[model samples]
Target: MLEQLLIFTRGGLILWTCKELGNALKGSPIDTLIRSCLLEERSGAASYNYDAPGASYTLKWTFHNELGLVFVAVYQRILHLLYVDDLLALVRREFSEIYDPKRTVYNDFDETFRQLRMEAEARAEELKKSKQMVKPVNNSKKQGQAQKAGFDKGNKKREGSSAAGATKKGWFSSMFQSIAGKANLEKGDLEPALKALKDRLMTKNVAEEIAEKLCESVAASLEGKKLASFTRVSSTVQAAMEEALVRILTPRRSIDILRDVHAAKEQRKPYVVVFVGVNGVGKSTNLAKVAYWLLQHNVSVMMAACDTFRSGAVEQLRTHARRLHIPIFEKGYEKDPAIVAKEAIQEATRNGSDVVLVDTAGRMQDNEPLMRALSKLIYLNNPDLVLFVGEALVGNDAVDQLSKFNQKLADLSTSSTPRLIDGILLTKFDTIDDKVGAALSMVYISGAPVMFVGCGQSYTDLKKLNVKSIVKTLLK
Candidate 1:
C-alpha cells in the first residue's frame, strides 16, 4: 500500500496530503526531498529515501512545471511497489485537469486518488504476471563462441589492414572532410561521427554512460542547426563536445574556500571542511594538503582526527599536524566520530583557528552503519564544506562512488535539510595524464565542482580545477 501521497506547490505550500501522517514523518521528508534533491537540481534521480526513527520510506516524485505543482508518493522500503510510477503519472494527469492555481486546499482529490491507485495497481499486476511467464535464454556459450570466432577473423585480417589501412585511415573523418556544401544536419548525418567521438571518449577513460549522455546532449544541440560550408562535420561535432565539456567542468556555485574561510573567521567560527570518500582514496592526506594550502595564506588550521574506526588514522593525522605545526584534536579509536568532530570544532573556535579540517574514515558507500555515522557528523557539525575525495584514476566507478555518496548522505541525514557533497577533490591527478575523464564523470554525477586536485606527494601539491585546460586535454 502507498504510505502517503502529497501534492504541493513549488513554494512549499501543501495543497493536499493522502493522510494526516503526523509526527511519523517527524523530520519532514518532503522538505528534505526539496532541499537535497530538487533544490540541488538532482530531481532527475529515480527516487529519494528518508529514514525516520522507527520507519524508512522510499519517495518517488513528479512535477507539473507549467502548473507549478509537485506530486510525491511515499511508501515503505520493503515493498517492491512497481506501480508507484504509474500512480504518480495518473495523479499528475487527473490533478492537472482540475488544479486551480489560486486554491490552497485540494480536499476533492481524495476520491480521484483512490480510483487512480486501484487502476495503477491493476495495470502493475498485469505487467508482473506478463514478466514472470518469460523464460531466460541460454545464449552465453553461443555468444562467447561467436565473439571468439569474430576476434580470430579480425586478428587474421589485422596484418592486411595495417598495410592498406594507412590509406583507409580517417575513413570516417574523410567522409566529413569530403562534404563540400552547407546543409541542414540530420541525425543520420551525425551518427557515424558521434559514434566515433563517443568511442574516443570511452577509450580516454570517460565512463561509457557519461560518454553516451554527453554525445546525445551534443547531438541534440547540433541537430537541425545550419552548418557552415567547409566545416568538417567531425570538427563541428568536436567543437560542440568541447563546449559541452567546459560547461560541465565549470563550477556552478562559489567554490572559493579562501573567501568563505575569511567570512567564517570574521564570525569567530572555524571554517570546518569534512573530508569523506571510500577506502584508500587519501582522505586524511588530502585533508592535510588542504590545511597546508590554508596555512600558506596565514590561516590558522586545526586537524580533527575523526577516522576513529580505522587503525592508525589518528596517528597518521597527528603526524601531519606535527609536521605542519598545527593543533590536532582526537578522542582515540572506538569513539563516536560525530562527537569527536563536534569537540574538534569547538576546540578550533576556542583557539581562534581559521579552519578545521575534519578527516573521516574512508568507507565504501554501501556501508550503512558507517554512512549513518558520517551523516550524523555532518548534521552535528554542519561543516562549511563537505568535499568528497575521489581518485582521478577511476572510470565508471567514479560516478557510482559520487552518486552513492550523495544518495546515502540524503537518505541517512538526521536533519530535514541534509548537506550533500559541496565540492570534490580529485586525488592522484598526476597519475591520470590526459585520461582526465573521471573529473567530468564525478562533476556530472554529483553536480559538485572539482575544487582541489592533488597532483603529488607533497603538501603544496593541491591546485584548483582549470576547466579550459582539462577540456582541451579531454578533447585532444
Candidate 2:
C-alpha cells in the first residue's frame, strides 16, 4: 500500500489509528501538529487504520542543543534515520568515549560517526545561512553575481576545512581501531553484535589483525589530550567504525560477464556448477539468473532441481525454467538429491547441453551431513564448478563458512577424483557497502576465483565478476 503522506513534527513519539484522519487528530496534541492536510481524496471515513512503525512523525528539533537525545536515537534506535543534526550529535557523544582514558572499538566507531555528523551539520549550516542573507533590491543582475560568489566561497570553505576534516578523521580513526582489538573502555552492546564482530574477525586476516592493533594505538593516544577534544575525537573514531562496517556489508560491484568457451574446455566438458548457501541468501534466485544468462549467451543450459529437501525449491526452479523457456531436469521434493543430480546430468548429456547448473539444499557450512550430501553429488555428477553462494551481509560467519566448506570440498575431491571444482559465486553484492575490506579479505582467504556476483534479486541483476569494477562500485 502507498503511504498517503509523510508528516513531520517535534514532540514525543505518539501514534493513533482510526478509520479517519480527523478521528485520529481529536486525541492528539494540537499545538504540536504542524498542520492537517487531506492526503488523498476519500468520500467517507478511511475504513481501515494502519499504524506505521518508528516514530509517529519526524521533527525538526534543535539538533545541537538536544545532541544527547538525538545521539541516543541514531546510535541505538530504529527507523530509516536521516538527519544532519542527529548525526552530528552521535559523533560528539561517541568521540568523547574514544578520547577518554579508556578506548574501545565501540568508542572508535562512535567517534568517527560524530565527525561525519559534524561535517554534514557544518555544510548544511553554510547552505542555510547563505540562502537567507539580505540582498540589494535595485541590481538583480548584480545580486545573482554576488550570490554565486558567496556560494563559491562557501564551497571552498567546505572543501578546505569541514569536509577534509571529516574525511581525514574517518580514514585515520577507522584504520586505528581496525588494528586495536582491545582498549581502555568496554563494550556493553548485545552479545549478538559482539559475536557477529568476533566471528568476522576470527579468521586472522590482514585487515582484522591490523584493526585490532589500531584500536590499541588510539587508546594510548588518549593519554595527553584534553577531555573535550579527546571526547570529540573518540566520537569521530566511533563514526568511522560504523562507516567501515557499512562499507564492508554493502556490495559496490557486479559480476556480469561470461568467459570465452573453448572446445578444449568443453572436451573436459559437461560444465556442472553447484550453488550452495543458507536459506534466503538468494541461492535459488541466483540459479535462475544463471540459467537465464546461459540461455541469453546461446549456450544450451539445463537446470537440475537437486534441492529436494526444501519444499518450494523445485517449484521455484520450475517457475524460472518456464519464464526463460529452457529445459529443467528435476525430481520432486521427496526424492534423494543425489538421484536428482545423477538424473539431471544424464538428461543434460542426452540433450547435449553445454551447462548443467544444480541448485542444492541450503545449509550452514558446518552441517556435516549436508557436507556429505554435497560430496556425494560431486562424486556422482562431478560438477566442474562448485560455486558457494554466500550472503555478503553475513559479516564474519561467512568467512568461517567458506573456510569449512572449501576444506571439506577439497578433501572430498581429492579422494573421489571427480572433475576439480572451479570457483565461487558471491551473492547479494548490492548489500555490501564501499569499504568492504572484511568481505574482500574473506574472498581472498577462500582461494577461489569469484566467478559471479548478484547485484539484486532479479534475473538481470547478476553480473560477471570483474575485480576493478567491484572495487570502484563499492567505493562509490
Candidate 3:
C-alpha cells in the first residue's frame, strides 16, 4: 500500500507531505535519506534511489532540476519504479500550477498538495484493481500436478472408501486430542508462539532487544499454563501480551495538572513543569497544548518563554499564549534561559497563577554546552516535573533523545537523590498509524511513562495515554 509522499527542497526543507500510512515522516529517516542523496548528487553520483535501513517500507525518490526539489514516496509493499515516476510527474505538474518559487512560499500550497494527494490515492486504487484482474491463474498447474500423481479410477474407488472410514475416526480423535492438549500447554509450544509475537513487534518498529524481553515476560507468564476449554492458544497469548504492555505503560502514568495545581495553590506556590527536547519536535506548540488543556480544567495557567536562544522562540510561545488568553513571562532573545525560567516562576508566584509551564530551548543531545545549561536550569528551579516532549514519528530517535537526556540530567544533579525525566509527552502520535514502536521503545528505554499524546493542533487534541487502546493497536 502507498503509505506516504513527501516533497522537499534540495536544502532539506520539507515543502509538503501527505501521510497515508498513518504516521508522519518527521525525523531522522527522511532527514538522513535527503541529506545522503543531496550529498551524493553534489559529489556527482548518479544514484537517487535509496532504501531505509531496517525500515518496513520502501522509499523511492527522484529530483526536479528546475525547482531544485525532491519527490519521495514511501510504500508498505514494493511497486514498479515506473509507477513512482508517474506519481511524481503528477505531483510536479500540480505543484507547478499553484506554486511560484520566486513569489509563493511552499507553506501556502498545503491545500493544493492535499488535492494532489487525493488524486494520487484514486489512481493507486485503479492500479491495484487492474493488477488484481491481470493476475496469472495457477489452478490449472495444481490440477495437472494432481493428475501426475497417478490415481486411476479403480485406485480412486478403493482410496475413497478408506478415506471415508478414516475421516469418521479422525474427527473423534482430533476432538479428544484438542481437549487433552488444553491441559498440556508446554514450553516448546510457548517458544514458537512467543517468537511469532516478537517478530510481529519488531515489524511494527519495536527494538529487537525490547521485543525479545517482552516476549520473555510473556513466556514466563504462559509457560506450563493450562488453556481453558473454549480458549484458543492465540487468544491466550494475546491476553498475556496485553497484560505485559499494560504493566509497562501503567507506571508513573498520572498527568492530572489541575489537581496538582490546586494542591500547589494551597501551598501558595506555582506547580512548575519544564518542557525539554531536541529542536523542531513541536516543544513550543505542545507547551501551548498543555496550557490549553489546563484551561479546560478551569485552572489558571501561565507560560514562561524561556526559549530565548532561537530568534522567534519567545515570539512563538507569545503567539500561542495570546491565542489561548494566557499570560507569558519572557526576557526576550539572547538572555540566559535558566535566569528567564527562574524569573518566570517568580512572576507566576506573584501573579497567583496555579501553574507555570516553562518552555526551554530545544538542543541536540550531543551539544554539551546546551545540555549543561538545561541541567543547570532544572537544578536551579527544581521543578515539580520535567517532561521530555518528543515526536512519535521519529521512531527510535525519540528513544535516544530521552535516554541521553535522562542520563545527563541525572549526572548533573548535585543532590544525592537522582533526578530523571518524570514522564514523556509524545507529539504527532495521531499520525503514527499502526507503527507505534516509538512509544514502546521510549518507555522501555527510559522507563518513563507517556503522560500525554499530542494528536492535533487544538488544545483538546492533547489526550492522556490509553494503555488498552495502544496495546490493541500494536497487536493488531
Candidate 4:
C-alpha cells in the first residue's frame, strides 16, 4: 500500500526511500494504478491527485525508522491527506478515534503508546513530588499532609480563638518592625553576621553556593532594596527576565484609566453610552450585545437605534430589543442620530433607567466631519461612557482608529465640552486567535484600558475587560 504512493515536487529529486518505493511497486498489483495519479501545485507546494472510476479505499500507515509518515485515502478519486511530518500532530488531533490497534504496522504503534504512557506517568509523578516540595498551598487536595498543608476551611475559626489583645498586630506593624530590624542590620558589621549565618546554614546541610547566594540576597534586603531570587538572577532567566523587564518598563496607569472612566461617568448629568466604530465592524451588533448584557445584569436598559444612515441598522437594534424584552428608542432612516441620542438620554432619565446605550452613525474615526458630529452629540447630551468599538480582526487598524479617536477627543474641548476616551470595546474576539495579544498591545502601547470584549455576537458574549485575564487567555 505504501509502495503505491508517490511523492513529487516541482524542483526536487525524490528521496532515496521514495525512489525505492517506486521500484518495489513497479511490478506490484497497484503499480499500474499508482502511475495514473497526477500532480498539481497549490499553496506553493505540490499535491498528488488520484482519479479512479469507482474505487472506495481507506489508508493507514506506520513508520518505525523515519522522520515522517503519511496515510492518504482516496474514495471515488476524492483524496484525504491523513498525516504528515515526524510529529504527526494532525493525526494526533484528528482521526485519532479511527486509528485501529489491530492493524499490521499499528501493532508497533501500540508499543510506542505504551512507552509514552509510562514516560508521562513518570513525569506526572515527578511533577507531583516537585509540587509537594513548594511552600505554596494547593487547594485541590481533600486532606492535608504535615509540612505541606493547604487552607483549612474546617478550622478557620478555632474553638478558643485568642485573648482580646493577643495575636500579632496588623500587617503594617509587623512589616515596620521587620523593616526597622533590617535597617539596623544594614548599619551593623555585615561580614561577621554573614559568616555566622553562612556557617549555620551550611551546618544545616545547605549547599555552600546556595548559602552564599542567600546571604547576598539577605544583605540586599537589609539595605532596603528588593532582593532577587537566585532563580531570577540565573544566567538562563532570559524569557522570565524579559517579561519582568517589559512590565517594569511599560507600566500601566490603572489609577488614571479608572479615574477617566469615572470622570466620564460623573460628567454626564444624563447618563448615556455612545457606541462608535466604522461600518461593517459590528458596532450596532456590539451595542445590542451591551444592552443585552446590561439587561441580564438587572440594570434597566434602553437601546437607541440611532444608526439612521445605515439601512436596516434600526431594525437590527429593534429586533434585539424585542428578543431581549427591553425597550428601544429609534427613528427611521432620515432622522439625525444626534437627535435620536439626545431623545434617548432624555427618555432614559425620565424612566429612571440605569443605562441607555446609543448606537451612533457608522463612520471611520478618521473622518473629521463625522467626528465633529460625534462631538456635537457629546456636547448636546453628554454620555457617561464614550466607548470606542473596533474589530479585533483589523489588528493594527484597530490601534490606528483608537489613536485617531483619542486625539479627536483631546482636541475637541471647550470648558463645557471636554471629551476624553473612557474605554475601548473590542469585538469578534472569539473568531481571532491573536486578538487578545493585539488588543492588549493596543491598550498598552496607546495607554487605553479596554473596558469590554465581545467574544461572540450573542448577548451573553460581552465580557468586562480585565488586563490580567486577557494576558492569561492570550498566553494560554
Best by TM-score: 1
Q: Cα deviation of 117 in candidate 4 (Å)?
A: 70
Off by over 4 Å in 1: 1-181
Q: Tell me which of candidates 1 and 3 scores higher on lDDT.
A: 1
lDDT of 4 at 124: 56
| Residue 242 lDDT, candidate 3, scale 0-100 | 79
Q: What TM-scores do the predictions have?
A: 0.65, 0.46, 0.62, 0.46
lDDT of each: 0.85, 0.54, 0.77, 0.54
For residues 278-297, could you state the per-residue lDDT of candidate 3 as single tens digits? Answer: 99999999999888888888
Among all windows of ten consecutive residues in candidate 3, which has the lowest summed lDDT? 39-48
Report the C-alpha lDDT of model 2 over 1-476, residue by residue, as the tens digit. 11111111123221211112122322232222212211110101212222233324322221111211112121112333344344434444444444322322242353454356457666766777877999757668888899999999999988889877888798787556545522333323122333344334444222564345333323322322223323334353443334443433333343223453335145745567888776677778888888887777888788889998888888988998898888889768778788888888778777787888899998776777777788788777666667777766665667677777777766665363443334566777777655344345555445355677788868889876655554444333
How do the residues 1-476 of candidate 1 rate in per-residue lDDT, one tens digit apiece?
67788888878888998864433454577777876666544454678999876788889987775566778998888898999999998998999899988888888888888899889999999999998896977769989899999999998899778868766776764566456544567778788899999888887788887788777667655665666767877888899788778767777568778999999988989899999999999999899899888899999999999999999999999999999999999999999999999999988888898999999999999999999999999998899899999988886686799999999999998777789999999999999878988888888777899999999999999998889998888877
lDDT of 4 at 402: 76
Q: Highest lDDT: give the candidate number.
A: 1
Clash counts per candidate, in order, are 0, 58, 2, 0
Off by over 4 Å in 3: 1-177, 182-184
lDDT of 4 by residue, 1-476 (tens): 22232221212222212222243322222222222221100111123333233343432222211112233322222443222222233333232443443432332344444343355446656766887895977885655564344345435445236432245455664466444432222314345655665565444333454345444533432332222332212221222222422342233444342344334446543447788877788887888787776666556678888788878888888888888888888878878677988888788767766678888887887787777777777777777677788887777677677777777755765434367666778888778753444564455434456777888756788877665554444333
- Which 10-residue span in candidate 4 carries the lowest summed lDDT? 36-45
Give the TM-score (vs. native) of candidate 3: 0.62
Any residue pairs clashing in model 1, and if so which? none
Flag the better candidate by lDDT, 3 or 4.
3
